[model samples]
Target chain A: MTIKELANQLNMSTTTVSRVLTGQEKKYRISEKTAQRVKDLAKAHQFAPNQIARNLRLQKTNTIGLIIPDISNPFFANLARTIEVALRKRDKMVLLCDTKDETTIEEESITLLLGRKVDGLLVAPVGEKWAHLEKTNNIPMVLIDRYFEHKEIPYITTDNYAGSYDATSFLISQGHHRIACIQGLVHTSANKNRIKGFQKALADHKVDTAQTFILGNDYSVENGYESAKSLLQAAEVPTAIFALNNQIAIGVMKAINEAGLHIPENISLLSFDEQPYFELLSPPLSSIKQPMEEIGIAAVETLFELLENKKVTSSRLKPTLIPRASVKSIVKS
Target chain B: MTIKELANQLNMSTTTVSRVLTGQEKKYRISEKTAQRVKDLAKAHQFAPNQIARNLRLQKTNTIGLIIPDISNPFFANLARTIEVALRKRDKMVLLCDTKDETTIEEESITLLLGRKVDGLLVAPVGEKWAHLEKTNNIPMVLIDRYFEHKEIPYITTDNYAGSYDATSFLISQGHHRIACIQGLVHTSANKNRIKGFQKALADHKVDTAQTFILGNDYSVENGYESAKSLLQAAEVPTAIFALNNQIAIGVMKAINEAGLHIPENISLLSFDEQPYFELLSPPLSSIKQPMEEIGIAAVETLFELLENKKVTSSRLKPTLIPRASVKSIVKS
Candidate 1:
């Protein structure tokens, strides 16, 4: 039954009936017995207290908004899962807004989130454009996995530059000079930092930058496979390859196998991020494993810090290197 | 500023002020000049119409609910992503309730969904006991992946029995007399059908049912690894193994590798569900692959069907087997 019908049945005004049902009549001098009766009838009828009505009375929605680039990606999916778990622990629900990497969709999602009146926001902004987001609302926001163009906002991300440099240097130390690199989207901060790291490794080893080879493309297994195929087909293929991500590495391995080449024998391989089945493959793959769980936990911690104290906070966690059999030393010709 | 302040500033009634702000008064005798003034004042003050208030007036939340066993699993994660994408296309939103494989949580999540007045529900029940869900609400619901104890409701799933039978028979044709099966949780209809199919294959081949072995566990990579470890340590290991899912198959391979046994030489392996990275491994994995995208699209279609007609419908899609390098013919001693 609707609130008006319930109010007529209880011989009370509609406003009084709504206030009682939403548990806001404690200060209204409504008798305890009357309030309890209204509650019992509402429960028996399976009546849902209108959230909008409750919000009108309380001036708060008690909901948080989350906007992420992609949910199909395992890393983002896991991050979303952890954030949901953490928020639930605090008795807050989340409204998830997936942008799918489209700027127009991202802006629309932000507007919708604002319209919903979420108490705060947890965003992983797409691309380098932050002006639209910065001007949207004064809602409390904590960015994760990527930084904002404006440094005023708090964000948490892994050290991509150092991680890439260390991964490349490890391969060089294994006596590999002719190395090929598979990179992600060029303009993204994460991809740019990774390229910088790869270059720094070559410079530190006194290897000519011109001798180092790089291929930039989208972050997909198919792209990785295509790039690796061309690299392997080169007149003088590199002795080792550094694939920027797990999916790319997997693709590269597929292309290599299709061409009758083997890992660490015909060509060595290294990648960022580790998958569950990485060790099961022939010649276990070595990788720069990002601290996923740690990052998830840390993002929540930063969000909570912002929630508790109305201040900005930022953090960047270091990545760890995992050595396996994917890389082999280059033998002199 | 409140609507009352805007009305006072414009020297109009609060109802007129709200009508202009909502664009409803033009047809109700309000002048365009007055409406523009109201709109300008509202915009200058960054005034947001209370959605909670509007929802209270309309008595609808405009949200859908999704209940899944585990969001962390890749299969379920992909399903959630598909549902989210579909909902976004229609300008509808979703509230995800992750059950984490607990029946109590499943029941609680349903209650929470009902409390929120979700327009419809998409659920993948955790176990055999789903009476609580059946009793919770009469809302439109479309079951996915798993079926209920009673078959009155609608669902969408892959043909597990047919896929399993074909995979097992293929192994038998390869001259394997002793075949071991690793099964998922027994409570699920998918697991039960898979086991039935595996046994049927052996019976059709005139093999002694008592000679074939079965190991039941959850469909997890770690469990697959542990089961494989135990099977390998046995006095006489099976010449062929069929893992019910990809995660278990991956674990089985790791266990075999750790035991210093070679695939196709020591033991041949086959599994259900294909992962993209599976072919990139040392020896490409052979699997019965489900049409994931089809299942996702079908789930949405089924949900809409239930929403429109309130009629129960169940659809099953067939699976295809992909032959790779993991399986080998058995040689008799």
Candidate 2:
């Protein structure tokens, strides 16, 4: 039933009925008894306002567009779930656009979301470019997980540098003079910061630069597999391997298994981002767990702040190093 | 720039310019030269049609509402990714509402989507009741993965009964007579049909019903863990455990690990719905792999057919049983 018909049947003005139904009774100074009476009748008639028509009149869709690199990736999937729940609590629905980690798709998704007139956007961009995103006409956007260095857009992300540095230090302390790092998407700030952290940790420990190696250009299992396979077959393999993400770590494990190598004994391994299955894996994988829930909550909070015209600043939360049985100690006392 | 502004600058009618811009040049019999001229100027000026205004005018939003029980679950996450890609190719964006496996949220999401006037809906219903969905006023919708048996809504899902039956038969063949089936959401058709298959397989094999058991009422790791823990501490533990879904299987594994029991040696384990990490598990779990990609593609096709007023029927695709190290050959001469 339409709200107008319900208002007529209740013997009340349409504005008074709308104010009561929309929870604006206090703002409009409507009497509590009158508001309750209108609500009771509206409920009895099962009346619902036409949100699309109302949204058009108000020029606000009350929807947020979420653009992520890969929805199938457990890290992003978990993050997306958290973000969705967080936004849903505030009565905002999400339009999910998975970019498949491609720059062109990311650009297209941004245009599509903007064209839908979403109240805000939360993006985990694929590439280093943000030119297409820059012309959003101030639609209250917030970058999540991935962002550009010089971009003015606010973002919430994990402290990748600290996470990586600690991970490298953990491996180094195990007496691993030679370590190989598998990186993802070379130009991304997350990847760059992780690489910096890995290198700095090695440098701080006075490890030889020539002994460490960095490889791969994409955040994928295949990239990790190929890099690990090549390294395993080399004349001298690194004593340990550090994967920048969980997908890469899975690939590294597959390669290790195929080569008849076991974790810790044959080669120690470490990965960024803890997965639910990590603990269930053989010997359990040692990982730097990203604070996905925190990131999700903070991103929504930042976006809502922007929607409210409040000044929002980018923030990064620390990641924790979860040491499992995957890493081996090579020191001989 | 607006279409009118672009039309005036090109010295052409707004309708002609719009027809070309919206990829309707062939339908409107607009010349190729005129289409090229219109596109060239539109691209140079970076002009985009306001989709919201245009959608309102046509009463078609080109958006589909997708309501799934869980997005963090790999099965649903992978399915969502595939559906999004398939629909995006048809120029449709998905408005995702993750129900978190709640019936109330499912109802609320349906109302929200209908309020926005989405072109179609694809839902993985959380519960058996579909009374709220019955009054959609002729909006196109296709249930995916989960649905009610008595509901008129069309759906595309995996053959759950066949998958469960085959898994049970495989276990029986391996000399596992005492088996326990851990179920998920007792009221769901998917779980009910799977239970039927498990019982039928045991009956065919002449395994005593009292020896075999069905436990758990939710699709969660905690349920699996609790059920397995109780069974493990019981007077007679089952020779093997059948987990209804991947989440339950993970929980079962956790309980087994905590009890210091090994897979296939102390007790065998089998799970419905294959996961990427299943093969990477300690003993590499044996599982029935659902055709998630096929189901996603079919659901979209069915929704689009409904959108075009074409006759559609609910169809079930077959699942494959993958045997790995978790299930051992206990057959004795």
The TM-scores of chain A alone, one per candidate, are 0.88, 0.92
Provide backbone clash counts, one per model: 1, 0
Tell me the tens digit of each residue's lDDT in model 2 across B256-287: 99999999799999999998768878999999
**lDDT tens digits by residue: candidate 1, B79-152:** 78888888788666777777776778788777766766677888888776877667655777878877864667
Report the TM-score for the A-chain of model 1.
0.88
Worst 10 residues of 2 chain B by lDDT: B48-57
DockQ (0 to 1) for model 1: 0.48
Worst 10 residues of 2 chain A by lDDT: A45-54
Instruction: Work out the TM-score per prediction.
Output: 0.89, 0.93
Best by lDDT: 2
Kept native contacts, as fractions per model, are: 0.45, 0.69
Q: What digit string (tens of lDDT, one per residue) describes model 2 on residues A1-333?
A: 777787788888889998998899999999989999998997786677776667767889899999998999989999999999999999999999999989899999999888888999999988567899898878999998878887788999999999999999999999998999999999888999999999999999999979889999899999999999999998889999999999999999999998998998989999999987788898799999999999999999999999999998999889999999999999989
lDDT of each: 0.80, 0.92
